[model samples]
Target chain A: MSLADLHFFKMTREPSLDALCAVVAERHAQGLATILYAGGTDWMVEQEMRAPLHDEPPLVVDIGRMGELRGISLAGDSLRIGAGTTYLELERSAVVQARAPMLVRMAKDVGAVQIQARGTLGGNLATASPAADGVAALAAYDATIVVKSARGERRIAMADLQTGYKKSTRAADEIIVAVELAPPPEGSPWYWRKVGARRAQAISKVALAGVAVVENGTATRFGVGMVSVAPVTARMATTRALVLGKALAEITAEEIDHAVDQDVTPIDDVRSTGEYRSHVARALTRDLLRQLGARV
Target chain B: MKISLTLNGAPRELDSAPLVRLLDALRGPLGLTGTKEGCGEGECGSCTVLLDGDPVNACLVPIGQCEGRAITTVEGLGEMAHLSPLQRCFIDEGGAQCGICTPGMLISAEALLRRVPDPDEPTIREALAGNLCRCTGYQRIVESVRRAAELLREGAAR
Candidate 1:
């Protein structure tokens, strides 16, 4: 059968967040599968492969238009990014560009205009791909993933969101609603790089995202997130500790490599091998320090 | 699903499946074959169409999501007899080589020209980044877009 035959899944559209929850709740109570359909950039690829559907054809709930799951706003000191906000919206939002340029940078690298025009920041987090640029960039900001269902709401830490490859802490009944994080500290260096097979459209083989608040040539607070080098998206706490209180220039490349080795558990996959990912992970650390623009 | 969308300049309705790819919906039931499909996946822009004024891969867009939206495909760019300046440039500049990528290229170019008339090489290149052409190198494609931008600007001035 052709790919067109793969379009056999049943779908339903929910008008509001409450309506979405009602549908999800009903599906959950029935123990049936419900796929939250947002930007279908990823889902359509799966359909092309004719991947096996759940026992019963799953209900593809169209929640791409619920207003509660859309928009980008600054809430007090944190940026509240609606889960349904498209990458194009993020790329163009004055609030996101001004408050979190790292996101803007990540947004530009996301699958060019076509994918970016539809892919969502929350969907990226929810997709739980190890090489998810959105998750990597948001992890660097120590963002919170807010998910809701008929039961209520839960805020999962970026570090705690993913449990395994294509796995997450999110329950079947829950859907990501928004992501909230404090923008990178003002005037601090924010860095994000996606090492892909090609410049655009290709998924990242490895990506590094780091934001540091250095004061007087010393690293005061920081977060470093890396992808395609772990079973799931990861933040480098060990590397963050290496120069937390020390001068940025004093931190050696070998020390960062050692810390990153402790943090990432990369393996040989179709996109890349463990060793190359480790090497780039170290190289990116050194690059981040070089970009700090701080000297003692 | 009874999907109602503004196609080209006309309002149309299709009794297509909600899960049907907009690309398949257009090509199969609706019978608009001008939008070619080089790859079933979203990788090739051969299936690019403007969804609500944004150029997106029609292969990845489901028909259900297109409710009450405007969709502009390659056929929507212009008629064959009276070609759009952008389509005419593709021919005169040799940008439409194998014809697989031209329709999508034209659609992407139309979106770009609408947003930024008289775009530079870099802007045009960036706008057409998603649409890939294998036969005629991107140089010719980019050049065609540059010329098309000039034509669009001239028409606007008039």
Candidate 2:
């Protein structure tokens, strides 16, 4: 088939955030299925795959030009990133580099220049891929997602957003407005890694993000976020609890292996076997811990 | 919908849906075939084009998002009788193999050269990382970009 064959039947390019939200809310009231699009990087492919299964096409709302969702700002100690801000914008922003270099690094790792030029931070989260690099990175930052609708807006913890695979706490009428990020504590050691088929333009097989602060060689703060280890991106709560307040050097692998086992619930899929993800997740977490140990 | 943008240094307008892929707009109605499509998905950089002086995957960009923006396809780079330095380097250094990925590679190389006139090997590699060329295994392509950069620096290439 010609490349031109892929086309959306119904679409409206919303010029503002308020209009976008109003359209979504109106559609929800009428029970018309809607899919919000920003950057269309992989969303179009997703739509094409689902074409054979559905009798009707979802209303495609183009939230690409929402001005309210387009910049990075510092709200006192926290960084507020507009949901419509493209990866290219993040990667190029000097403010982002200084305040949240990990986010800049994450932006660079997202599908190279082409995808980065179009893919938005909020769009990646909304897509809610089980092993998305953005989700894993945001989880590491302990980011809070701000979503809005005609009704109002609310903040959802990254850890609390995902309920399961391809599902989230976000309602149909709501769209992500911004992602609020609190910078990691000064001098804290953080690690982010995405293992994929290839370095560039490949989806993650096992994505991991971690942060830790060792004061005089004792763990003061510890957190880990991993993708492809469960039905959704997961915060390694059990693992963090096990490692917190412990000496970085004395943290044992056997104990961590058990803690990670409790934290993640991986399953076999086309990308990888669950067993492999389990092993990689453990090894990578420990590797991050080791890095933090040496830095201290 | 009416989308107005600068294409190949000329201001043009397109009448189409808001979500029609820029790749389709280029090939179907605009009649510019230099931008090829390897994977209609954004995975392959075969449809890479310049949007307001930045390289982007045309396959993923909706024409509506391009309103009043500047687009540079491979055809905009140069003509056959008067090849751009990057295109000349591609031919001289055997950068293109099987020809499908050449347009994208040239566009990416052009963007890099425009930004960093004296880019190193690693820089060149990173710039063209998204554009995959299976035939030449990328050594010649990298060399081609390096050659173009040198010519550009010397003012011998335009």
Index of the highest-lDDT prediction: 1
- Tens digits of per-residue lDDT, candidate 2, A1-296, equal 32333454566767678888888888899998787778888776664455253355677777777688888998788999999898889989987888777778777878988888888989888988877888888888889999999999899999899998979999878889999987766545778888888888888788888766678887777667798888888898888787775676787878778888898888888878889888988888778877877321
- Which residue runs does candidate 2 get wrong by more than 4 Å? A1-8, A52-56, A185-187, A294-296, B156-158
Instruction: Report model 2's chain A TM-score.
Output: 0.91
- What is candidate 1's lDDT per residue for A27-104, written digit by digit as tens? 789887788889988877876567555456778888888889998889789899999999899988998888888888
What is the Cα-based lDDT of residue B78 in candidate 2?
93
Q: Model 1 clash pairs? A: none
> How close to the true structure is residue A7 of candidate 1, measured as C-alpha lDDT?
59
| Per-residue lDDT value at A124 in model 1 | 89
Model 2 pairs whose backbones collide: none
Cα RMSD, each candidate? 1.8, 2.3
List the per-model TM-score of the A chain. Answer: 0.94, 0.91
lDDT of 2 at A223: 65
